[model samples]
Target: MGKIVGSAIVSHHPGLMQCEDFRRMMGAGQDSDLIAGYERLRHKIEAVKPDVVVIFDSHWFTTGYHLVDGGAHYEGVYTSDEMPWYLYGVPYNYRGHPAFALDIEAVSKEMGGYNRAIAHSGLERQYATLNLIKHLRFELSDTPVVSASSCQNCRPEHFLQSGAVIGEAIRRSDLNVVLLASGALSHRFVDIDWKPNHPRIFHESNLSSPENLASDKKAIALMQDGRHDRILEDWDSDFRKAHWEAFGAHYLQMLGAMGGAECRAKGEPLSAYENARGTGNIHVWFDA
Candidate 1:
């Protein structure tokens, strides 16, 4: 089998490529800053130059657990640019142009059995898989790529199961595997009120104010004080209470991918920022 190696995690926040602070973090270059975080990540990937690249994003799917084998020939459901979903919803465009879309409903139906992590609703297995396709279509446009074959009906017991699927794919293919898990750390929507004992409210809000660079500093202080674990366990309700679910699916996905059976959790925050809207965008990664 080809060497099973090289993994990465890239933030999908539109602000990542747009913000000056983020660029500064990236410019840190191998020392004393968040960019060095990615430098270590790159070295890990280089050590295992995987050929079969599997990029998984927690935000992609809508319903069920899904997987897209990039090497397979599969039919995808397309939603046009004129579709209502794009008008008032989060519009995903690639390279300055609109793109074809896939339906998560199909994938969810294809993959039976679901998990209800949150009390009200959560991403179904099918939706997650379909979202991956849409994300890949937009992120990797302008390339000659085969369509993705959807994987359904698998309820991952834990994050390890997710990695096992990728590992199995690598064992089956002639190419080395590059696994990408995309998600953020402690960010929440504008409406989310983390309700820390002493809330250090920054100017206006962190979501929409691009000028408010100090909020991230506050977040770091909160983190340094060892308040992050509470955020992790209570994030589902506390963070989601603000109007959106903290996308921890990617965290779980990465755990499942990297750990498999012998996986233990070791984590670090790579980058953190709040948009003009006060929504926090923090990139975190874990190792097993």
Candidate 2:
């Protein structure tokens, strides 16, 4: 039976797409740890040698159904509409695991969950998935990738159900998979006018508010301790109030795949927790 060999919660903020010199300049002479964290994450992934990487793309927001990119292959130049200037004209070419995606759909149906696998060549690509591909240098390897979208209309429980479907599908298949939750912690962005006043945009002090910073830190601590149960328990009362990226579905889905509240996978920090325009970003690897 196939199984999840590993998983991670990674940052896909547009700032990471910039050159090292520019990134350092913005960070007051320090490069975003996410830059070096990619290399470290690459080593972790290589050690497991997964056949496919399933990305829970927080940026790819679908309306009613959970969509899976089932294309046989993808190749083209991508430019982010959200931040075109920072992430423009990026070339990407990668194989897709259509069979595995189809399996996820089948399992979803059995579980009465909403899921669809689309192989349309015209489907758009988001930076959440592409950025990781570029940074991890997936082009240098043969591992195929498939991206799953967050259903914007769903609540936390729905995302967890989708993840359970995916987990069951993976277990039924023969592909060793790595799950990547591509999103941020507290996702409140700074107002446009605040940039001039907060020049140190990458620093923790610049996070949206003290509450957001504390919420992110608490969540991170819980993750490190393998206490996802507490995080989920406080989702509505605490973490949700801080407004996690993509409503935090990226993380909930990934956790669901790993056994949800029952999961006790310890997370190791691959990069220091940092700020991205008031949002909480980090690279954390969860041992499977």
Q: By lDDT, who's the top model here?
A: 2
TM-score of each: 0.45, 0.98
Candidate RMSDs in order: 10.7, 1.1
Distance (Å) between predicted and true CA of 170, model 1?
2.6
Error of 2 at 89 (Å): 0.9
TM-score of candidate 1 relative to the true fold: 0.45
- Candidate 2 has what TM-score? 0.98
- lDDT tens digits, residues 1-288, model 2? 999999999999999999989998998788888899999999999999999999999999999899999998999999989988778999999999999999999999988999889998788899999999999878779679999999999999999999999999999998899999999999998888776335555778889889999999999999999999999999999999999999999999999999999999999999988888889999999978
Tens digit per residue, CA lDDT, model 1, 142-220: 3212111222333334333444444444444455555555543334445545432212222224343232234344434
lDDT of 2: 0.93
The CA lDDT at 69 in model 2 is 92
